[model samples]
Target: MNKTLLGSIYLALASSIWGGMYVVVKIVVSVIPPLELVWMRYLVAMVSLLVVSFITRQKWRIHKRDLLIIIAIGIIGNTISIVAQETGTMLSSAQMGAIITSSTPAFMVIFARLILQERLTLKKGFSICLATIGVLLIVGADQVDLSSKLGGISLLVAALTWALMSVLVKRVPSEYSQIMVTTYSILVALIVLTPFVLPRLQAINISQLSHPAIWGGLLYLGIVSTAGGFLLWNRGLQMLNASSGGLFFFFQPVVGTLLGWLILGENIGLTFWTGSIFILIGVILVIKEKK
Candidate 1:
């Protein structure tokens, strides 16, 4: 298969898993605080990915010069991004969180052009506009008032952190395998989160462990959404440029919105359809542009 096609497939799979993550997180958050859940999810992801790395014999070494950069990626990209996302979800409705998080791709494009010195194309410019419109429609202009100031700000931070992670991942040395980068990133995130883990642990209800839903959600989040999704996303990034890879995020909101409706029985009204069309059109234009 073509590399682009493969990248698209990987991104699609990642997006679908991410879309369902909102619902899973909602269920888990009822039983566990967001901070504790975030730590546990990363811990589970770290262990699972480490096992895979060991079995696959993926190289674990990094160049001395690149060590700092990798560490920064781990802290800023993985740790901060996850924390921001979880905090944002806790502050807002799942659908609202998903919609706000969808802005990450647009922010990625902007950052790539400014930081990576990548040239922008008309298609990408168009995509930014369309995605903005879609977000507005998805959230409904009138419902904007529903957002608390702190929640809106938190979600914005989540979008920025997510975008930063995408940019930082692009800077990973070519010599390091994507799997290696992902594994180490998660490990670093686990370490960074250790300080907060104990406090959250105190709040944990041991009785909840017996509840299948809690365990199921944690397993799904750890194994599928965090580990599997990140691996696929990193693979897609390796195959595609930052801008192109970022464009794939456009599909996330659409997938997430549909899942929200189908699985959660959320309303799907005219605004969703209208805004989604604009976002889709914009994403197509962005992908068609040449690097």
Candidate 2:
């Protein structure tokens, strides 16, 4: 099988996991504050990845010049971007948030074209448009009001930061192990989040930690979503051009809708299915693109 094909699969898998992750995060955040939850997520993810690194006998050393780059990536991609996203969602409706996040692929495509000299093929352009429309339909964007300017702008920042991070991942030296990079980047994020999460952590009692649901959610967010998901996503980005890799992010909303239907008893209307078909077709078009 082609490496690019395999990379696309990895990206799709990671995005699908994240689609369900939003659902889990919603439930978890009901019991934990968003910033604190993210902090714990980074902490757990860093440790888990470190364990994996040790088990795999991966080198922990990194080039000095790359240190600042990884730190910047951590701040932009994980900490600040996540904070902005949470703030935007808090101030806006879910529909609006989804619609805004759907633009990330477009930002990534643009960035890859400008920075990496990636070609913006006609087929890729059409696929992005089709996917964006599908997302808007699925998210019921017609109902969203742009009146919440702060929320809208925050989401825009989040989207741009995420796109920048995706491109930056491609800039990492190919000789470096992606898992090591992931672990280090997450550690950097955790360090930056420590002060913010500490005050919140002090309020939690040991009894709260004993709750199975709390522990379960944390583990899922940290181990599965953060550790496993980032590893796969970075690996995929390493394998493919940032523009092509960005298209797989479209899988998030599709899987989210399906999970809602299955787990939350959410209605799956005709429009929803139709939009899903469009998204899938768009994804397929990108996946089939040859290097």
Candidate 3:
């Protein structure tokens, strides 16, 4: 019932959901372009969020001053960062994408320090090091392609922007419902992406909708990954400090690897288990920290 513990649960659930999302994306993305798929996911999430808001009788109104931060969060994290992440993945290998983007928590620590003035305790610092090592071991640095200069740079942009957006979640007045913030922020992303996504809509085979997997996959992605995932992640950040809260982002790879092995029958070896242990230690360290 402690705030940190509850927040940790929220963050973990969000990241784990995202980890599983990769499998779904792998299936659905073949039927849909990444950006188009993202646009559809947001549209689904938008409707779902609105329905929840209406049910909860949550106020849609937000302070005028906070509007800027909300828009910034939308543009930075939801739109640009995601687009770049997809672009990077397309240009580079999964190993490279996994390795590059796992630095998000470390970047979150720095942003939290500079923007929110959160102190970097030795424990938090050490935990990040541990998690980063775990990611490298799991992702396998040997498979990374040095030739993917643009892809590498794009992924770094994704990491940096997402880290900044996560920290910015702390800046929105705590009085506002994170649900409202998340919903409206996603709406902003939809608006921004609409112009780009609309034209491509014609290209997609409407016939693809007849396939159960494609339709079902988008529904899960929108409802679970975008709506549920973003809400839990933002709500978690409300209760926990950005620096420490960011540690949960590491759960994505761990859960992803596990689900990959379980669902996709992906091969795993000693390094996967070893990396998971390190990641667990990193998250457990912060959860135990009082401050």
Which candidate should be chosen as best, given lDDT against the real structure? Answer: 3
The order of the candidates by lDDT, greatest first, is 3, 2, 1
What lDDT tens digits, residue by residue, belong to model 3 across residues 1-291?
999999999999999998887677777878788899889999999999989999999988888888999999999999998878777766677778788889899899999999999999999999999998898888888989999999899989999999999999999998999889989889899999999999899999899877999999999999999999999999999989999999899888888888878887989899998998898999999999996
Model 2: weakest 10-residue lDDT segment is 86-95
Off by over 4 Å in 1: 145-147
Q: What CA RMSD would you report for each candidate? A: 1.9, 1.8, 1.3
- Candidate 1 lDDT by residue in tens digits, 36-57: 8888888888888888988999
User: lDDT of all predictions, in order shown?
Assistant: 0.78, 0.84, 0.90
Best of the two (1, 2) by lDDT:
2
By lDDT, the better pick of 1 and 3 is 3
Count backbone overlaps in model 3.
Answer: 0
Q: TM-scores, in order shown?
A: 0.92, 0.93, 0.96
- Per-residue C-alpha lDDT of model 2 across residues 171-248, encoded as one tens digit per residue: 888878989888878877888888778877877665776688788988999999999999899999988889878888
What candidate 3 gets wrong by more than 4 Å, as runs, is: none
